[model samples]
Target: MSSARTVHLLRHGATVRPGLLLGHVAVAVTPQGIADCIRVAAGATFTQVVSSDLSRAAECAAALGAPVRHDARWRELDFGAWDGRDPTTLPSDALAAFWRDPDQAPPPDGERWSALIARVTAALADLPDATLVVTHGGALRAALASACGFDARQVWAFDLPCAAMVTLRIWPDSAQIVGLRT
Candidate 1:
């Protein structure tokens, strides 16, 4: 492993609705989400705060009381046609197929998981020594998965709770998972 750079990856606060993909949609944080994120990051000493342009992520970053850099690259996976659809309503085979090999699957006209991985990799590569990134759950998982060479199955296993903070160590050759939260 190379010299590690500390990264505090914060998942955005929860939105008003649940069980919806909400990909590329701009949804604000629920009241409870704002409170929870403020509580979690209140004591953190961060160098800088970066967030997705979406309102939910931006609101969470705002609670940190630091200037935030909003970037579209950190947005969640685009679900495209499935953005507003209920997962339960999709064909059973559809989910199974995607889960089996997410890299090859694109959600209708949405972005592929591989593309997400590549974009996140580039973002991390360009990050400074230490930073606090507030983004979507899927975005966090993509970073972790790429750093560790985790496959699609293992990537989905990463459970990022709303307003949770995960510490990641990024290196030139590899990355390490430092910590996680509820």
Candidate 2:
């Protein structure tokens, strides 16, 4: 028999501040969005459930009706001075540079992309055999980057929308994405 494990990474749903750049901000999730998240996780079973400590992600995780481990390692990449600001208000050139290589051009004082990968990698390492993680989009992306062996730019190809769930089957040395649903 194989010793592979399954990990379900789910991004939190819409927040009260929908369009703003939210990084490490404890913004609340909209009621409807919470309902949507609950619907998405309905019928799912896992031996362990985890979530980011941020309110948005934590609320979604709570709605799943499980005793969850709220971890800061799964928090979104902190946007620093740009946190909770309208992305449109930021300098286009800087934003473009961040998109090209976030670690090199991260928001002023924000958490670097590489740093996020490190924390998320550690968080994933501690997971049990069957786990459901309610986290932010960036955290999910960071996990994907590690699982798929994709670089910063290449990882953006994944379409992780609000309330989306991606299931990864992992072994000691490798991982495979078995399913994804939004």
- The model with the greatest TM-score is 2
lDDT of 2 by residue, 66-161 (tens): 898999999999999999999899999999999999999999989899999999999998888889999998999999988777799877888887
Relative to the true structure, candidate 2 reaches a TM of 0.96
Candidate 1 ranges beyond 4 A from true positions? none
lDDT of 1 by residue, 74-173 (tens): 8898888888677888777876776687668667788889898888888877777678888887888888887788877787787778888888777788
Candidate 2, run of 10 with poorest lDDT: 39-48
Local distance difference test, candidate 1: 0.81
CA lDDT, every prediction? 0.81, 0.90
Residue 5's lDDT in candidate 2: 83
In model 2, the runs with Cα more than 4 Å from the true position are none
TM-score: model 1 vs. ground truth = 0.93
